[model samples]
Target: MKKIGIYLSFAALLLTVGCSDWTQMEPVDQQPVRPSEQNPELWAQYTAALRAYKAGSHTLVVASFENGSTNPRVRRTACAAFPTRWTPYR
Candidate 1:
């Protein structure tokens, strides 16, 4: 049948093209490399900045503005509760 001939031609084409030599490709290493290996001071400074920012430093202030509108009374109450730590945004 014509269908059998078409299927046979497709199978022969696939078999001839699929025999590629992939052995020349480079193998990937399984070991993980540390950042300090590339640059020690750069890695150290990066870690220090991360620590400083994570500890609630003013360098990276987070604002909360998800709720509908910010209530003036709530803001005043929060500022009154923590005056030294709070800095109002204009």
Candidate 2:
């Protein structure tokens, strides 16, 4: 029948459109490495802050370090150690 032929053609067209080649997805830049990654002291400071937060010592956790350290590297290291989150002392 002509209706059956038309239905098959429409189904073929739908299948052709649905079976697209989706292999080339855009690459995502996941979790970029920071310059501080190479610096051991900076990493230590960051880890210490994280540990303090985990240990629930909110007061001891430094939000920001004094910027006036004689060594610029020390100041930078301390700055990186700043806590990412602050919880009020209960």
Candidate 3:
């Protein structure tokens, strides 16, 4: 009887530790879908930025914007639009 009680206690302990509420603890999917992954124009802009940086012409980096706008607002918008590739310089 004592042996059976010990075995049952161990089994209960194992059961309590092994079971988890993974469904409640799972991470939420809050990420927005990447535009560059889907859009060709955005991908091209990213490539051009990389090329401009490599060519040692940081000014030309923003000039590659297909929208033909030198406006700082437009540039900022373009920078925010593709964060995965472009990082703001100081």
Candidate 4:
């Protein structure tokens, strides 16, 4: 009876390990190129703005970001940052 139980447990373990569904797993989606590669101007603008902010030059960082890009998304995102990014201009 003990030998039969061991055989059944071994068969259950084998089935559990062997029956995993690899076909359902999908490959990772990869970016074709970095955003900077396609839009260097925007990337440079953001990088400079970030550095200016980190260097504690809060008032001047806004000027550096306003690069006159026609993209509304950039303008909107930057505008949204002003309220939180600054602290009473101390």
Candidate 5:
């Protein structure tokens, strides 16, 4: 009885702990924009910035992140630190 009680408790704990609520965004008709094709001006600026970074003119860190994860402060700081890559970063 004690072993059965322990097993039942463990199963209940596992079931509850494993449950999670999922959120779904409203559906969109259009496909998502590709990074390179998003903006011509920003693409040009990013390329120029990449070249400069390669030439040792300045350090550059290219980060691929989701829109939901974008932070306002990080965007502002990245733009302020390196103007050329600003548009692409956003």
Candidate 6:
């Protein structure tokens, strides 16, 4: 009975280790998504903000998002997130 149990365990381990081909498996072919694809207006806002941010005026960048946004959270978030895109922290 002990020998039978050991053999069954070894067989199970072998079956698990040999279950899949390491090289022949296909890679996932998922395409990257851009904000422009889902919401062009939001993309435009982000790009405009990014351009403004690159030019060094942050106040106008945050204020540009004043009232046109339907979601207040995105407005507040964009205010916080844009400036941190470049950092030296030194």
How many clashing residue pairs appear in each of the predictions shown? 0, 0, 0, 0, 0, 0
Q: What is the Å distance of residue 5 in model 6 from its true position?
A: 9.5
Candidate 2 per-residue lDDT over residues 1-90, each given as its tens digit: 999999999999988888676655878989877757788798889989989888884555456445766566653466666668996768
Residue 82 lDDT in model 6? 58
Please identify which of the two predictions, 3 or 6, would achieve the higher TM-score against the true structure. Answer: 6
Among residues 3 or more apart in sequence or in different chains, the pairs in candidate 3 whose N, CA or C atoms overlap within 3 Å are: none
The weakest ten consecutive residues by lDDT in model 1 span 72-81
User: Candidate 1: where are CA atoms >4 Å away?
Assistant: 1-20, 23-27, 57-90
How do the residues 2-30 of candidate 6 rate in per-residue lDDT, one tens digit apiece? 99999999999988788757647688999
lDDT for each residue of candidate 5 in 1-90, tens digit (9 for 90 to 100): 999999999999988777643344667799889778889889999999889878886656799634444455566445345555437634
Pairs of colliding residues, candidate 5? none
Q: Rate the local accuracy (lDDT) of all candidates.
A: 0.74, 0.76, 0.74, 0.76, 0.72, 0.76
Better of 1 and 3 by TM-score: 1
Please, what are the lDDT tens digits per residue for candidate 4 over residues 1-90? 999999999999988888777546878999799878989999999999889888884554343555355555654555555676657767
lDDT for model 2 comes to 0.76
Instruction: Report the Cα lDDT for residue 48, model 5.
Output: 96
- What C-alpha lDDT, on a 0 to 100 scale, does residue 77 get in candidate 5? 46
Q: Show model 3 residue runs off by greater than 4 Å.
A: 1-36, 57-90
Error of 3 at 25 (Å): 18
Lowest summed-lDDT stretch of 10 residues in model 5?
Answer: 77-86
My TM-score estimates for the predictions, one after another, are 0.37, 0.25, 0.29, 0.30, 0.29, 0.39
Q: Model 1, range 1-90, lDDT digits (tens) per residue?
A: 999999999999987778655545778989877898889999999999989878864665689635444564565444345556658888
